[model samples]
Structures are given as structure tokens and as C-alpha cells.
Target: MNTSAFFEKRVGWTKYTMLLVLLVISFILDLIISIPTLTTTPKLGGIRGTSSVQVPSSDRIGMERVEIGIGIGASEGCMWYGKDDRQCRYTLSFQPSSEFLHLPPKQNVTKHFPDGQIMATCHINTALQAMVTTSFIFGPFFAGLLPFTMILLPITVFMSIFSAISLLIASGQVAYHLKYSIPSFELQWGINSILPFVVVFLQLVLSIYIGTLRCMMRKKNPPPPDMTDEVRLEERPRDNTLG
Candidate 1:
């Protein structure tokens, strides 16, 4: 007896799943990092304390106080001397990490501190905005449709490249803003900044690989031609048996 077999053709599913997961990770990280109140640690305070030789209690009065130029913003106050009683005061301020990227640069913030002191500066640049938009919109959209079709593979590759470039530029902008705008506090880059680069690289490499595989698969096993049900039935071989 002889048997007929049909072998179904398919692409690499492991790599495809990896690419989807990578894009999803990028989307999540981007969304989390964009939050306005998100802040990272290792922030250096502006104040520096000095040690003095042991002295009388009376002489130690006001010795611990160090003069630092503190910026004050609107809707906040300094509680230096006392809540009610007041003395010469300065405002200590620190803003969240995301505010450095989202807010407009030209906004007046005044408090009970010296005037003209620069607080946190927030300016969203094109690269940063692009990266954010890609992560929130493009990343998820591409990831969602990737498993179903190969048409978006090439576009995903390009989007990954664009996202990587935008992320690099955004990192530079954030670093610059942190270094110059608010030098008082030293903010360190956490996982939020680092993981996106890795995700982007994986996405780029996986998409390119998958796209190449797709091309190869197409060349190896061309898609079957479209046909009507009647034609398909007519093409089917009829079995004949003799008893």
C-alpha cells in the first residue's frame, strides 16, 4: 500500500516570538519612563556640609548653616526658621526625571527664594518626542500585527532603526539637560534608560533576520495560487479501486 503526504510550509516561530516580545518590552519601558513623576536615584543634593573644630555651644550657633543658592518655584514655600515665624530663607527644590523631558522651557516658577535662579528645565525635543511616539504607538502596533503577516517586517526594521536613533538623541538631550539645567542634583540613569537600547538592538536584529527568512521562505516555497472551490475539486485526483 502507498500513502500520500502533505508537508505544510511555515516560517521560524521562535525568532518571530522573540521580536514580538522585544517590541512589547520597548513599549512598556517607554510608557513607564514617560511618566512625569518618575525619578531615578543617586541624586546629589546641592548642600555641602563643612566640619569645624570643636567650639563652645554659643559659637556653634549659625556655624552649621551653609550658604547655598537655592531656587524657589511657585506654589511652594521654604520652612526654614519656622512654619509661622520667618527668617532669611532659601528654597530647596528638585523635580522628577520625566519633567525634564515633557514640560515647556519658558514657564515662570517663583517661590520664597532668590529671583532669577534656574530651577528644572523641561524641553521636549524632536528626537525624544519621536522615540516616545514610536514606543507608545509604533512599537505596540507593529508587534501586534507581526505574527499575522510578513508585510510589516521591513517596516518594523526601519522603525527599529528610527527608534534607536531617536533614543540615542533623547538620551543625549536628557543628559545635557540634567548636567547643565540643574547641576545641583546629580541624577543617575537607571534601567529605564538602559533597557530601551538593548530592546531596540534586539528588535532591529530579529526583524532583519525574520525578514530575510521570510524572503527565503517565499523563494523556496512560493504561495499556492488562488483558485475557486470547483476548480480545486476538479484538480483533485479521483481514487479508483478494484475488488
Candidate 2:
């Protein structure tokens, strides 16, 4: 069988197309996480604190409950009077993590000033940076190119594996710091933290499956049966008929 034909036939276009879809989803999710503008409320919360700032609406001073948004690179937060009401004119500023990705790292929300305003700063780490960079590189640009060029199978596999492992390490670091390092803040984790892992997992699965299929196809196809000797032996039957 023709190598290209066999590849298309055996693997089927549907699965390959699915790979593209998955990569697209992964890239979008990555972008969603990397941008600091959007904040998602987790079903389970993280790093909760109370500030006795005066309520914006009324002179009645009440304890404002603040919760840090759980995120991979950066997070935004909201202040609440109670579970039902939001404090007015609230602003949560996250110190930018790195100029490279422009995402704020794991946040530390503190009230050090006399005004009772929460100052949020990034605790930047290498692992978080790695995750962001990996997503940017492997997400859209490479994903678009991969479907056209089948030669990149091995490279994609290696990159996906590296990305998954690095993300795992980064996630562990974030979890450890949140649990032990910040005792004063109540830690709550939400969908933001888990979404990146989902992306990595999808990439890993796609890369490995496609790579393995390519390898197996190569072994089965076997290089056109080496016709050198057969060509040489094709005799001069025409000469015998003429004689």
C-alpha cells in the first residue's frame, strides 16, 4: 500500500480531525487562563479573608469577605458584603508575573496598609512560566502546522510529554504553597486551576496515539519490497523471439 494512502486509510480522517479540534479547544482554554482580565468563581473557594473596610453604599462598617481567584498564571478577585451582595467600586489588581507571558503568578492577597485595601502581588515561579510558555508555543501555531506536515509526529509527542510533566510539577508547587505557606488565607480551588491540566492531557493523548500509529504503519508498509534484483533479472525475451 502507498504510505500516505495507508496512513490516511488506517488512521481515518475523523480521528485526525478530532485531534485538530482538541488542540483548538486546548489553545482557547490556555488563552482563557493566561489572560488576567477574567476571573471565574470556583465551586470550591480559595484563600478567603475578611477586611473591616467601610461598606461603599452606607456608612455602616461591616466585614467585607474577600476571596482570591484560583488560577494558573493570574487571577482576579471580588469583594462581597455577604454571599448575595457585591461591594461596590471594587478593584483587584494583580501584580504582573512576568513580561514574557504577561500573566500574574500565584497571588498573595494582603492588607498591610492602614486603608484596609487589599494589595495583591505575584509570587512568581519558574514552573508557572514554563506552563504558560508551553501553551503558547504548542497551542495554535504548531497545531495548525501539524495537520499539514505529518513528519512532526515525534516532535509533537516529545513536546506534549514534556509539557504534561512540567505542568504536573508546577501544579504541585502551586498546591503546596497554597496549603502550607499561606496560613492566614483560606484556600479555595476552582475550574481555572483544572482547565490547563485538561489541555495537557488532551495533547498528550493525541500525540502518543498518532505517533504510535505512524510507527506501526511504517513497519507494516516495508519499503516497496526492494525490487533491485527483480529489475536486473528481467531478461531479453524479445531477443529470443526475434532469433
Top candidate on TM-score is 2
Q: Candidate 1 residues 1-243, lDDT tens each?
A: 000000123443455456556655655544443332221211121211111122224466653322222211211222121122222232213333222222224422211113211221111222333343344333222433323334554454455455445544544443444344422323344343454456556556655665575455445432233534555688889888755
All candidates' TM-scores? 0.42, 0.43
Q: Write the per-residue lDDT of candidate 2 for residues 1-243, one digit (tens) a residue.
A: 333444466666677567667656655655554444323443322223332222234345653332322233333444443344442222334221122111123323221211211212111222333343344334322322334334443344344445445544544544554344322234445444565556657656756765576556555542343554464467424455655
Lowest summed-lDDT stretch of 10 residues in model 2?
Answer: 113-122
Candidate 1, lDDT over the whole model? 0.35
State the local distance difference test value for candidate 2. 0.41
**CA displacement after TM-score superposition, residue 50 of candidate 1 (Å):** 18
TM-score of 1: 0.42
Question: How many backbone clashes can be found in candidate 2?
Answer: 6
